[model samples]
Target: MIFDPSPIELPSSYEKVETTGHVFVSHYPPGTPAVTPVVIVTLNRPAKHNAFTPQMVRDFEKLFPMFDVDERVKVVVLTGAGKTFCAGADLEIGFGVGKDRTADHRDGGGRVALAIHRCRKPTIVAMQGSAVGVGMTMTLPAIIRIGYEKGKYGFVFGRRGIVLESCSSYFLPRLVGHSNASYLVSTGGVFPPTSKHFGDLFNEILPDASQVLPRALELATEIAENVSPASSYLNRALMWRDTGSAEAAHLIESRVINHMFGSEDQKEGVAAFFEKRKPNFKANLDDNPPPSVPWWTEIDTGRSPKAKGPSKL
Candidate 1:
C-alpha cells in the first residue's frame, strides 16, 4: 500500500541548510513520542539543478549519523526538490580547491557516502529526474534506487577531467560489475537509466519522473512497517561486508542466524504468522545490533594527521 509521504515539521529542525536531504516525516506513531517510521530526504537545490556543494557535504556528514542512531527513523527515502536530481558538484567555486594538503584531504562526497553506508536503516534513493557525476554516484550506497525512465545519467568524471568520488570505486563495480563501471566511466557519457550499461544499478525505472518519489516512499513504508530492521540491516551487511572464504561466511552466518533466531523480532514474526496479523518488530538497530555486527575491520576514515608546515618543519 502506498502512503502520502508529505513533510510534517519535525519537533526540532532536523533540516540543515545544506549537505544532507531536507528531512520530512511521513507518519507519526500512535501516542507517546515516536516521531515517524519513514522519512523523505530532499536534495533541495532546484535552481542549480540540485548540484552538490561543500556545505551540503558537511550537512550529510552530520545528518546520516543522526539517521543511523535515531530509533524513530526506520527507513529513509532520498529525493531531489525539482526536475533534476543533481547536475553534479557545483564547480562555481571549483572542486576541492581547499587549503588542506592533498595527503590530508578526504573527498567530501566519499565521506557522505561512508556515512550513508554505515546507517543501518534501509535507504531508498528517489531519482526524480536526471542526475550526473557525483550526483549519480552518491546514491549507489542506497539499498534500493528508483529512477525516472527519461532521466539522463552518467559517471561524467572523465569529461570533467576528474576521477570517480563517493566511493563509487567500491560500490559501482559491485552493483553493475567492472565492465559496466568501466564503460560508464571510461566513456563518461550520459545515458538513460534504461541503458543496457546500467545493469541492475537502478532497481526500478518508472515511466515518469513524478512517480519516482512516491514509489520510493512506498518501498520505504513497506520496509518500515513490516520488515525487521535488525534482520534487514544484517542481511545488507552480509552482502556488502563479505567474508573472504565460504567457511568464514558460514561461521558468521551461523552466529548471526542463531542470535536472530532467539531475537524479539523472530518471536514477533512467528507470533504474527500464527495470529494472522501484522508483526510489529520492535528491534531498533542502534539499541540492539546483532552479534558480531561489525564483523569486518572498521576503517578510521576520519583520521587525518596534522601536516607540518614548511616553516615548522
Candidate 2:
C-alpha cells in the first residue's frame, strides 16, 4: 500500500517555534479519533545523501524536545527525506574531530542520542537506505526501527579509526546481545537488516524502502489512537529504564497499576470496550495525569570518570 503525507496542523504551543532547516517537523491533524496524533521529523539534506553534520546534530537536539513537551503529540516518527536515511557523519568537515581536548567537550552524535533516549514520547525510526556510523548508532535510543530488505547498517567507527558514539555501547548490547554488539563494532562490517547475526534489530523488514515510513506511521497511529498517553509514556519508561532488575520493575509496575486502576483513562478504556465505541479519553499528559506519572525525574547515565589528578610516586 502506498502512503501519502497528510496535511499537518501545528499545535498552538509550537506556533512560535521554528520548524525549518535541516529537519522538518510536522504533526498529523488533530480530531482523528481512528488515528492517533503523530509528529514526523525528516532529515532534509537529500543532495548529500542526508549526511550527518554538526548543524543537523544541533537541529535534532532541538527538535525532539518540542514534541516531548507538547501534550498534543503522542508519537514521533523519524525518517530521511531522500532515498538514504543518513550516510553517517560528514567526513569533509572532520566530523567527531575537535581541537578541544577538555573533559567538558561532548560528542555531537551523543547529544542527539541522549535527547531521543530521554524523550517521553515513543519514537520510531524508518531506515530507508544506508545508515552507517553515527546514523546507525543514533537510532539505538529510539523505541522501534523499520527497515527494508535493502537497507544497510553498520557500526563503522573501527574502520574509520574512531570509536562508537551515541551511547551505542549501552543500547546495542541490550538490543542485540553483548556478543553480537562486540562483533559488529569490532569488525565494523556493513550488513543488511536481514543478517542473522543482527537478530531482531529491525522490528519489521519490508520488501522495499517505500514501505518503511508507511509501516512506521501505521504503528505510530496505533499507539496514539489505541493506547493511553500517560500509560504509554510510563510503560515505555518501565520497559526501557527499569528492566534491569525484577524487583525494580515490580515496584514501578505496582505503583503504576495502583495509580491507574481507578483513573479516568482506565475507566474510559473499559467503558469503551463494553459500549463498542471509540472511547474519548479525557486524560492527557498536560492535564489530569495520574499522580504516579513521571515515575523517574532524572536520568543518571553517569559521565565517564574524570582524569585522575597528577600523582607523585
Candidate 3:
C-alpha cells in the first residue's frame, strides 16, 4: 500500500523508505520539500518501546544522508510508533550483538547514531516514551527536542554499567549543563519531566502526544518557508561542535567500540543472540577500558576516526 504523506503535510518530493520488515529503515520516504515539512523517520517497534536493534541503526545511517543531501528536505522529525519514542538499547541482544546476519550489519548501530548526529538538516525529535541509551544519545543531537507529557526521556547508561557510548557524553552536558548532565547520567533511568527546568533539553514539551506531530510540523514548515537551509545547517553544526559534544562523542565511541570488540562481553553477546538467549557478559567495561575523557573537557577537534573524508557529493 502506498502511504500518503499528506497528513503530515509533506511535499511531492517526499518518498517512503521501503519498510520490508527490517528494523533499520522504517517508514522513511524520499526527501521532499514544500512550504510544508515532511516526516521522514518513524519508529515502528512500539511494542518493544521502539527499542533499537542493529538493523534500525543501519537504516538510520543509510537514510540520514539522504535528508542531509536533499536540498528540499527542510526539517526532519523523529518519533516512535505507539506509546514510547525508543527504549534505548535492546538488553537481550546486547545492543547489536547478533550474528552478522548481513555482512555490514555488525556496526550498523554505531553508524546510524553517527549519521543522526552529523546530519546537516534540522532535526526534531518528538518523544512520547522512554528514550534510553542510544535513543537518548540520538535525541540530544537533534536541533529541537519536543517531549510529550507522557513521554519519558532517559540517559540510562549508568544502570547498565557502561559509560555513555553513543556520543551523548558530549551533547548532554552542553544541552543541560555539566552539573545537570552529571546528575542525570549518574542517576540513570527515567528522568523527571520538569518542563521549566529541563525545557533547555527540549524546544518545547507538549501536554500530550496528540500535540507533538502538529507542533513539530508547524515549526518545520516555518523553517522551510523562511530559513536558509545552508545557514541553518551550518548553525546547527556549530552548536553541535561548540555547545553540543560532537567531537568528544567521536572519540568516546571509537575508544569504546575498539575495546568492546575485543571483550568477552561482545563474544558472549554475539553467541547469545544467535543462540536466541540473553548474553552472559562477564567483563566490566570500566575494568577493561578505563574511563577516559568527558566531552566537556579534553577536546579532540579532528575529523571522526571513522570518517576518512567526505564522500564525493
The model with the greatest TM-score is 1
2 or 3, which is superior by TM-score? 2
- Over 4 Å off in model 3, which ranges? 1-16, 19-37, 96-110, 195-199, 243-313
In model 2, state the lDDT of residue 277: 78
Judged by lDDT, which candidate is best? 1
lDDT of 1 at 217: 83
* Residue-level lDDT for 198 in candidate 3: 54
Candidate 3: lDDT of 282?
A: 38
Candidate 2, which ten residues in sequence have the lowest lDDT sum?
Answer: 304-313
Tens digit of per-residue lDDT, candidate 1, span 21-52: 43222332223233567766677778888888
Each candidate: what lDDT?
Answer: 0.78, 0.76, 0.60
Native-structure RMSD, model 3:
18.0
Please identify which of the two predictions, 1 or 2, would achieve the higher lDDT against the true structure.
1
Writing each residue's lDDT as its tens digit, candidate 2 over 140-186 gives 88889998798788899999998978888888998999889999999
Expressed as tens digits, the lDDT of each residue in 116-182 for candidate 3 is 7766677877776557777778776677877777666777778888677656666778788888787
Instruction: Give one clash count per candidate, in the order shown.
Output: 1, 0, 12
Itemize residue pairs with steric clashes in candidate 2: none
* lDDT of model 2 at position 152: 81
